[model samples]
Target: MNITINRAAIESIILEVPDVAAAEAFYTAAFGLGDKLRFRASEEPTTGFRGFILSLVVSQPSTVDSLVGTAVEGGATILKPAKKSFWGYGGVVQAPDGAIWKIATSSKKETGPATRAIDDFVVLLGVDDVKATKQFYVDHGLTVAKSFGSKYVEFDTPASSIKLALYGRRAAAKDAGVSAEGSGSHRIVLGGSAGAFTDPDGFAWEPHLASQ
Candidate 1:
């Protein structure tokens, strides 16, 4: 089922890292997740999971392996090996700047050769309360596409745009293979249509002018 999604879509994410040049080099060599991502420089001290995860959903198992391989080669620490799960096949990696990323695909079998193509990009925010956060976003113009009680929530988005979702803090940490404890800045900024305000989980979103 589809909901009445807002026309104002999420543009890109600005990640604050200690070294912008290094991060850019790593990402460029890794997945090339597309232009939906942006970066900045900040030495802000952030520990643990940083309350979020960036996921790259691909076409097939070969694509998943391809992306994950380059990510590891680019100084990323593998949190989980690429393997098949009940839901699908995927793996997790932590960037040098302490960001967690999950490369995954719903297809277990590879139909063709591997390529650097991203079918979807997801930003999973770890919130304190899933249901309340879901309502907060809904109140701020986001429409829910999927809600699994208090466990998870996925917001509807336009094609080729950034996708957003919410998950419990502890669960998100566990999924990233990290401790569920962190303090200080999340080291992230979201440029989107939800207006200039921080969400219930301290995730900030700013109104963005659509790039020409």
Candidate 2:
């Protein structure tokens, strides 16, 4: 016999956009994302309902693709183009600032097996300098959280409430009790309908279809 319990789950990717109105318009026009919620203030975007809402919050710029050119010029590659994701369709671009943004649809459904447990997941980025990396995130849109010496810094996004930490790759390896192998050590696990990535440093991330 199986039992089911109702637990609140995280259902959206809260992305930091340069401009709220423009970003909103970009998704609507370019991807046909239906509008479900909005905010009067650019800083705080209030979302109604739960489950896979692609929440894009405008940062301090003017439009959705405002940073697109800068990102491409700064060695930022389009790891994945805006398409239908398990949660919806959109693109994932690494910003010149070293942060990857997933511009996608808010209507995508989440795909996962039923697990009785739930917890927040934190994404840690390996960088050469924590302070400088943290600064990059701050300059873009993410807010800086706690700092553990000059070796590490934490940044917060509105989506998960969990904090993403930036640290030296070697330091992160030490913390994980693994040798710091860098990006070369990472691997991608692509299954039939689900997939995850272990960046060269061996940090694992579970990425599902944006429209699963």
Best candidate according to lDDT: 1
Q: How accurate is candidate 2 locally (lDDT)?
A: 0.39
TM-score of 1: 0.93
* Alpha-carbon RMSD of each model: 3.0, 17.6
Off by over 4 Å in 1: 1-8, 209-212
Question: 109-169 in candidate 2: lDDT tens per residue?
Answer: 3344322111333445566667776675555445665888778776544443333567786
Q: Supply candidate 1's per-residue lDDT for 77.
A: 96
lDDT of 1 by residue, 1-212 (tens): 11235743577888889888899899989978545677878988777679999999998998888888998999999999899998789999998888899999888888678677888889999999999999988888887999999999999888757899999999998888888899999998887766798888898887665551
In model 1, where is the ten-residue run with the lowest total lDDT? 1-10
